[model samples]
Target: MTTHKKIRKAVFPVAGLGTRFLPATKAIPKELLPIVDRPLIQYAVEEAREAGIEQMIFVTGRGKTAIVEHFDMAYELEATMSARGKDMSALDATRATPGDIITVRQQVPLGLGHAIWCARAIVGDEPFAILLPDEMMIGTPGCMAQMVEAYNAVGGNLISVLEVPREEVSSYGVIDPGATLENFGGALTEVRGLVEKPPVAEAPSNKIISGRYILQPEVMRTLENQEKGAGGEIQLTDAMARMIGTQPFHAVTFAGDRYDCGSKVGFVEATLALALAREDMGAEVRAMAERLLRA
Candidate 1:
């Protein structure tokens, strides 16, 4: 029997050149783009922290240094804010302890699997998580935290999934479910297999893989020999598919709203959705949205 080790580290694959956002992403990473006030990556980091993850391994690329600096203490800025009698509490969550964060560069633009493989040294031999910064999941207990609780009960490999429209299944990695679990708020499903970006007719099921993953370290080893799948680049889904029956793989259906911030429309929707949920801005934003819609 495989003894489940506690998941303490999470990998953030942020090496992608955000071609979708072009000029804006040319200088600033898409992960650092503000969803309202907080950057997209900050939400992922906070979710990981909430899930009992102690270490953060960022697989970064060129011009992504801003992400590193974002998590570090800005003494001068804090002092200035303090002198101005401004509240510094908002910045508290962004701070991290020294050495808690680790970064590795993926010099070549390989793929998602390759980006995660770059963090192999830091991940070592333990169960870890992979959170995509672009997938902004808004939930009460948090998505990753919910997955961590499920992982504690049944361990092996876990990935967050959502039921998408049948026609839209081709845009994601569709899952083949084995058995339905009775607990965890009825959001858990046993993963039988995974097909990456399959055609609508050939898709195994409507349940598509979302951004959050609690993967075993063994998948990294599998990725080392993984060949390119769909787009002539190493795909993470390909490696995970190989571990299907060998491990206790499951998919947790997320209970929150997910925003694919990788796309322009999705990013704007997430920003507005989050803004509308804030107590300070909800009513005003709602009224403004109604006026704009009416115009």
Candidate 2:
């Protein structure tokens, strides 16, 4: 049996401008926007915790201080709630477990790789998972938890993969699988190569990359002197591609519903799906949705 290697740290890149949401995101980080009641970023952090990730490192930018503060203890609010006999559970919900969360400011408007590079000192030397708040996957065991399990078994860099429409290939990173690993517990296949947002005609397969990733530390070394690529951004894909032949890289076909919460339509869909799952609101929400469909 492969020895279990626990992933102790996770990197979240939350510094994006969120230009898709436009006016609403003008003052708020899109990650802070709620799906139903809970903020979108909270789901990503919770997923990390569920996967045994002890430290959550966030790469943030200016005006993103609220993202850090939201995960920190709100002592005054907790105190007031206690004085008013309010449910402590509600107050406790705001706090991340002690020593579990930390924030690093990405002062420059670099790309995802650069944002992750800012947290290098804190991440130290170990394989780390990277979760993007914009891509929220709803699942029974949670997306990152599943990826962690696969990573533990295979002991290499793993990325969440799923099939997308052929025309949509350019919207995401595509995977090229050389062979299928036998007896792998879940829907996972050893990845032969990766192509970044390739045109539909050139895409090797329909499998597009998802947001969850378990990457080896060596990739950071690649990113150390990585030059800008594709759209003039320091693409993380470029760095990972450099690690291809050196390290074992694979893709896990995650079983779940992924919401592109970065987009307006996806945000609405997530809100509706989560809201309709709540016992108190489920019936009414279902009825309203049915009525709207009928009309």
Candidate 1 off by > 4 Å: 1-3
Q: Please write out the lDDT profile of model 2 over residues 184-251, one tens digit for every residue.
A: 76488878788988888999998988888898787787888999988788888888888887888889
lDDT of 2: 0.87
Candidate 2: residue 11 lDDT (0-100): 98
Q: In every candidate, how many clashes are there?
A: 0, 0
TM-score of each: 0.97, 0.95
Candidate 1 lDDT by residue in tens digits, 14-133: 988899999899899889999889999999999999889999999999999999999999999999999999999899989999887999999998899999999999999999999999
lDDT of each: 0.92, 0.87
Displacement of residue 286 (Cα, Å) in model 1 is 0.5
